[model samples]
Target: MTYRLPSLNSLRAFEAAARHLSFKTAASELGVTAGAVSQQVKKLEGSLGVTLFRRLPNGLLLTPQGEAYLPPVTKVFEDLTEATEAIAPAINSRKFRVGMSRTVKQMLPANWPDHDVGLRNHIRDRIET
Candidate 1:
């Protein structure tokens, strides 16, 4: 059945942006650009006819509606993640996985884990995207 609701992408953008109170942080976590996050949040606000944030020159502050909305949205995402993991145990296994962004990786020393050969012994594989 078709449902009338905001797009999932917009909802995800709002949830991440509101949680961090920064489009840039949300974008980093979501693997998108800060501008994309801002646009999605803006489009969501327009569709909902609600002002969700007060954009200050320094940072963001949630409007009363946004404060009210964040909890349920966060809960839904948590539940979705939990359910997905439950059905796909390998995805949530005990295997050690390192997920890092280029910006974050650059913050570390150039030789990082490589400098410590012992670290590589435990890692069966390394994948970069």
Candidate 2:
């Protein structure tokens, strides 16, 4: 079945902010800036046409809509985690090997010009000595 949804990032931001009840705390947990989390939550709210939180002087309070929205969104993420974990080993173990043509390898320079010498000069000098 197809699911019409807001952006994953927006959803993630909303979920984190809801759990923490503070955009700054959520931002810290998500490794982003507080403004980024707030913007994402705003984007999610716009897409849903609902205000998810009441912004207060000190912190945030969840609106009724946000209270209703959180559980299902959290469930979706949990399901996603379970599915990814089930497939993780195969995903992790798969190797991507790249082959370059001899001509392409030859075309690439191994070292910069003489004026850019540092460790390269030391190595070359040692080799020459």
Candidate 3:
């Protein structure tokens, strides 16, 4: 069956804006300008033919429709993140195997890479040659 849905970009804009209740904050999270987020949300509302947020002086308030829409949209984003991570092992582990010659290893400290906390997490294993 064919399903008619709004664009993913618009949905993401709406979801982020609704959650933060501020287009600026949402834009920061989305790595876009505030105007871009606002435009995308406007596009979403246009497609849905419903107003999701009420603009206020301080911030935003979710309309009743927005309150209802948020849960499923958030769930979709969560599910999508999980799905993508599952398919991409590098994204999940994001670690690498370290290989070094014996001379190079001897040049460094005994702990070597492990001495660095941030580096240790990314190094899954060390192989000496």
RMSD (Å) per prediction: 5.2, 12.5, 7.6
Clashes of each: 0, 0, 0
**What does the lDDT read for residue 5 in candidate 1?**
88
Query: Candidate 2: where are CA atoms >4 Å away?
Result: 89-129
What lDDT tens digits, residue by residue, belong to model 3 across residues 1-129? 997989999999999999999999999999999999999999999999999999999999999999999999999999999999889956877764556677877899778778999977777776654
Q: How do the residues 1-129 of candidate 2 rate in per-residue lDDT, one tens digit apiece?
A: 998979999999999999999999999999999999999999999999999999999999999999999999999998997899798856544443345676775675764224355634433222210
TM-score each candidate. 0.75, 0.67, 0.72
What is the C-alpha local distance difference test score of candidate 3?
Answer: 0.91
Which residue pairs in model 1 clash with each other? none
Every candidate's lDDT? 0.91, 0.85, 0.91
In model 2, the clashing pairs are none
- The deviation in Å at residue 9 for candidate 3 is 0.5
lDDT of 1 by residue, 10-120 (tens): 999999999999999999999999999999999999999999999999778999999999999899899999998989967754566889999999998777777778875
Candidate 1's error at 68, in angstroms? 0.3
Q: Cα miss at 79, model 3 (Å)?
A: 1.0
Once fitted onto the true fold, the runs of candidate 1 whose alpha carbons sit more than 4 angstroms away are 93-122, 126-129
